[model samples]
Target: MDCCTPSAGRPSTPVAAPPPGSGDHRIEQVSVPAQTFAMGDAHGDGAPGDGEQPVHDVRVPAFTIDATSVTVADFRSFVTATGYRTDAEQYGWSAVFHLALTDPDQVIGQMQGTPWWLGVEGADWAHPGGPSDVAADDHPAVHVSWNDAQAYCAWAGRRLPSEAEWECAARAGLPSRRYPWGDELPAAGHALNIWQGSFPAVNTAADGFVTTAPVRTFQPNGYGLWQPVGNVWEWVADWFSPAYYAAAPVEDPQGPPDGTARVIRGGSYLCHDSYCNRYRNAARSSNTPDSSTGNTGFRTASRKS
Candidate 1:
């Protein structure tokens, strides 16, 4: 259960920005006001088709996200004020996660149904695992695409939270809460940074991390947000439909106007609970908005706070 990677094998287009406000890469956001919750998987514990389930409703009107997940020094200050080139650095390669491969000879191929996902070739987002493995200025920037998080939300004027404003700021309005701190599993030890041991074969970092962990590592969700589920897999702006919750749209439902994958919400650091429990808060998954992987990453949104 490699959480995700490998899709849209090339050209999904849309990654040419600069000049929308162009460069502040702001972070700590929050707001999330306009109510209406119960969006999906009211604990039937989804995953078949993964529309999450019939537990519909939704709403989402206030918006303002990004209380975390976008680091690597806020995407290296938007690639140092937009030199910006990442569709896995223009598809030279990405997807590297054979246990975050430090360099087993920079292997440039894998993913025939997730062979622990190892494409490589200088694995992007500032060399994730190939090429001497850099990247980790406070983690959570991984390989970056959904068209490079819409060119870093069009250079940080911000935009990207719309899986019902990312599950109403990851269920902070807490009701069908499998977690954003609700159903159980946090007496303050592993609030997130998933996968304990035995994933692609023995991680045991317990919570300390085996791949991305500091997007503020843990604790913060009653709207303060941080690490909204596991340590990565964010990228939301819709267009993924495992039957888009049958007829989605209780109010703000902006998804599925077209498709070929887009949505992705929490659940990363490889995730486990016997293979991608999807890290919770009515989990979901998708890719190919120009896929990039090392467990994915994104976070930004604002209709103003």
Candidate 2:
């Protein structure tokens, strides 16, 4: 959950440059369109894991994303337009959600393995359940990293989403399907905002959300974008290496040259199936780019003007 961008809390943004190609702001920036798919399908039947195994073919071309993830008023307008200071508020504390202290007068064990995180201190991302909890300035800003999502995409001029353009905009064409608006899962009510009943304990907000869920709630996929897979896990400038996709490069394969972990892409809101199913769409994971969590978060990319 740590990438490389952690300066402390609140203070980011200052790279600006965008605006000129039709000003699609208000955080609904869609686009996509760059054809070609089938990147991996490790055969869990309809492919479930093995880092989305061998199923190659990428291509890529068109760009633009961020229909969601990066909220909290878009990082408080990039820290009121660039003062930048994240990396989980400078790593004073993070990894929260220890089940609000499983009762018994709140102690229920220190948790860490899966009591549902809980490392808390001052926590970060505007104190998500820490520093006495605050967030909801409009969710989606969970302990950011990858260098505070590249300083909020250089102050929203944009950049960050190149694990083949974040898995070709989270496989919104249904090449394999496990999620990304397919393969059923968002039941009970319909789509978006994960972690339903029986998680660290029980949520049962159904899909209305027991946490997060604001940046456009649910439903959008086929290019309209929004949530890509689940709630968070973006950050893909590329650095991970699970055999470097057997030497990558079917086309737009930029990843691995050196590595300590980076690539994250989709899967958040504590992606279930017991523990990290990677929210599908060619599931892949890696961390430590700087490590900041509570269900990681990031988004922003460009260069297709």
Candidate 3:
């Protein structure tokens, strides 16, 4: 099955949010104004199959979104109150980066295309590297599937940001820059967390992180949103389609009506210039909604009711 595919036997009912102010943690939501901005790959030099083509204009209405990704502490609160189990927990395994694995012998299997990803039993959000590896409270929650994120949103009275809204907020009012900061890449360890040296076998950790970092480790974008381009591949509300930009609506496009996989934006700590430079603002990818990895996480958005 595709990486983003939902499990066949999972429950379909939506979980309701808890009573207001019940949870101890709160996500700081930033208000993004209604505006028309250019979206998609403007540089045209991103990695192939990245679907960064046909730059277009998108007008997104005013919305509020989390200023930072949902940290482990935040998700912990949701799970504590709702008693929900992530897809990773239900499946008894989740994809983990080879570097994060403390014991290679524990790996049950490996992803076909990406051998660097090892399927480790018990590797869920709480156990990023399996039972031996516990997640840090301040780190952004990893190994969360899109389905899991939706569940969290439901419990928090929030929703996932649409691809258009995500890109709009990521740009931070900058029209043509390749990243949230600017066109020039920030020196390693200076800005976002991304692959420093070679990918896969060699990660120099120039950004001071081999795995997930604290959610607010880097500087905020112009809009005060943190790490919009790097750290982890964030799950968006839209479904994935390489050709969606070709005929996408100009105003508030949510993405295709349906798709095999859901959209994931921003690159991850594994991103490198040599390969998968999807750290660019317009770059995007997709995976099965049920897929969860150490390099993926998500923020929340709220629309005025």
The C-alpha lDDT values of all candidates are 0.79, 0.66, 0.82
Predicted candidate 1 versus true structure: per-residue lDDT over 1-305, tens digit per residue: 23454563666677566545568766767887888888878878767877788888876777687788888888888787767788777768887888888888878778778777878887888778877888868877888888888878877777888887887788888789888878878654577887776767788886787888777766788889887888788888888888888888787888888977888887887777686788888888888788888878888888754
Top lDDT model: 3
Q: RMSD of each candidate? A: 16.5, 16.7, 3.3
Consecutive 10-residue window with the lowest summed lDDT within model 2: 1-10
Error of 1 at 286 (Å): 21
In model 3, what lDDT does residue 249 have?
Answer: 94
TM-scores for the candidates: 0.34, 0.32, 0.92
Identify the runs in model 3 with alpha carbons over 4 angstroms from their true place: 1-25
lDDT tens per residue, model 2, 148-266: 77766655567787887777777677777767766767446457666767766787766766666776777778877777766777778888776777678877777877776678877
Q: What is the Å distance of residue 247 in model 1 from its true position?
A: 38
**Top TM-score prediction, candidate number:** 3
Candidate 1 vs 3: which has more TM-score: 3
RMSD (CA, Å), candidate 1 to true, equals 16.5
Given candidate 1, what's the lDDT at residue 290?
82
